[model samples]
Target: MTEAKAHIVAAVAQLIDEHGPAAVTTRAVAQAAGVQAPTIYRLFGDKGGLLDAVAEHALATYVSGKTVAEEGDPMAALKAGWDTHIGFGLANAAVFGRLTDPARGADSPAAAAGLEVLRARVRRVAATGRLCVSERRAVELIHAAGTGAVLTLLAMAPENRDLGLADAMYDAVLQSIVTDAPVRTADGPVAAAVAFRTVVPDLPMLTDTERALMAEWLDRAAGA
Candidate 1:
């Protein structure tokens, strides 16, 4: 993004932060950004488009600055990611709401990025032979649980909120999708398939067709 666009987005975000989403008019953002209202329209198309940009900018910026634990422990990194998702949702309620809205969410780059992050974390856990489910399933479960937890908490009065709810939901999700290192670790054959799936492309002595076929088989096994 250009400096001018960044400045406008930052200004709009600040306006929403200080005055709430309902108060953010094009004129207000224009005044705040020291630009004409038409500039916002010219750049963003309309108010909805502008709001979309703000949501994208907020999540992208937050994710860029977020730090997870140092490498080597994928579980720790996954836990950190869960915590970060919950914290981000609670802290940026408006942007979170915007991103989660059915109409906007389908087209939301921010929401997609968030899911991609979860996918990567789940893939790492799978690669470590710790995940019990397919990466896709794990991502869906965790994402749904996290979003539900945040929404549940957001629905309550702040003082009346149960701060432990998020953690509790996470624990439940982990119990459902994570293994405790049973006799067959990595959630058994399905998890093994998932772990192996990651390396299918790099397996030596395999033609492109063979690698593609192997990946397809692994995907079926993992999804089983």
Candidate 2:
């Protein structure tokens, strides 16, 4: 990004943080960035484009601070990520609301990157043989739960919020997706299939097609 574009995006993001998404008019942003409103139009095309840039900026920062635990308990790492996600949403309500909008977020690379972070965490659990469903299913469950938790909490007055709601949602998701202990292939095909699915690409001497075929079969067996 050019220095001037960076300056404009930062200015608009501050406007969002200070006022609200509704306050992010071209006039306001232009005033904030000390440029003509047409400069914003020239640089960003329009308000949606400006907001998209801001979303990418915000999610990039948010995703960077996130760490999928490298050691110790993978579940613990996932829970930490959950907390971070909720905290950011509550703290950045205006921007979070905009980014969560289906129309805008559907095409967002940063939003997709955010999902990949969740997928990595799910993959870690699967690799540990603790996932009781397909990795795709586990990721979907956690993502839907997390998004619901944030939106539910945001809908309420902060003082009226159920402080335990987010934790309860996490527990519910865990119940559906995680096993208390690793399951052996003899005990169940689902968890074992999920576990092996993580390593199928690395399996020795397999052609790409072979790996793909195995993955398809495993995905079906795991009920994704």
Candidate 3:
């Protein structure tokens, strides 16, 4: 985006931080950004377009600053990503709400990026042979748990918020995803299916056609 566009988004985001989403009128944002209301329309097309731009800007900025411990354990990296996600939600409630809101979420580029990050982390875990569920299933479960935990926490007053809820949710998701090993172990039948499915294409004993068919069977068996 151009510097002018960035300035306008920044001004609107600041207003959201100061007075919540309801206060972000075009006139208010234009005044704060030192631009006229027509400029916002000319640049963003409409209020909804402007709000979408703001949500994209906020999510992209947050994701750009996040780093997981890639040199160490994948689980640890996943945990770091989880903590970062929760922190971003709490720090930017309006943006988080906009990203997760059913009306807008399907079209939100940031939400898709966030999910892609989660999928990458889950794939790392699956690579270690420690994932007890299909990578796709694990990603879904973790994403759902984290999003629900953040929204739940946001619903309460700051002083009244139960911080443990996030940890507990993480624990629950971890139990469902990981096996009982320091790093690599297949724990159950479903997990076996999930793990085997991940490498089915490379199974030397099976022909290409056989591998393809086996993958379909394992995917179903893995609940994916």
Over 1-224, each residue of candidate 1 has an lDDT whose tens digit, in order, gives 77888899999899888988997898888999999988888888999888888989999887776554437788888888888888898889988888888886477665677777788788778777667777888999999999899999989998999979999999999988777653253338876787888778888899999999999898898784
lDDT of 2 by residue, 124-143 (tens): 99998889899988888888
Best by TM-score: 2
Residue 204, candidate 1: C-alpha displacement in angstroms: 2.5
TM-score of each: 0.90, 0.94, 0.85
Scored by lDDT, the top model is 2
Predictions in order: lDDT:
0.83, 0.87, 0.83
Which ranges in model 3 have alpha carbons more than 4 Å from their true place? Answer: 67-70, 182-187, 199-214
Tens digits of per-residue lDDT, candidate 3, 183-213, equal 4233367766766676676689999889989
Q: What is the lDDT of candidate 1?
A: 0.83
lDDT of 3: 0.83
> Per TM-score, what order, best first?
2, 1, 3
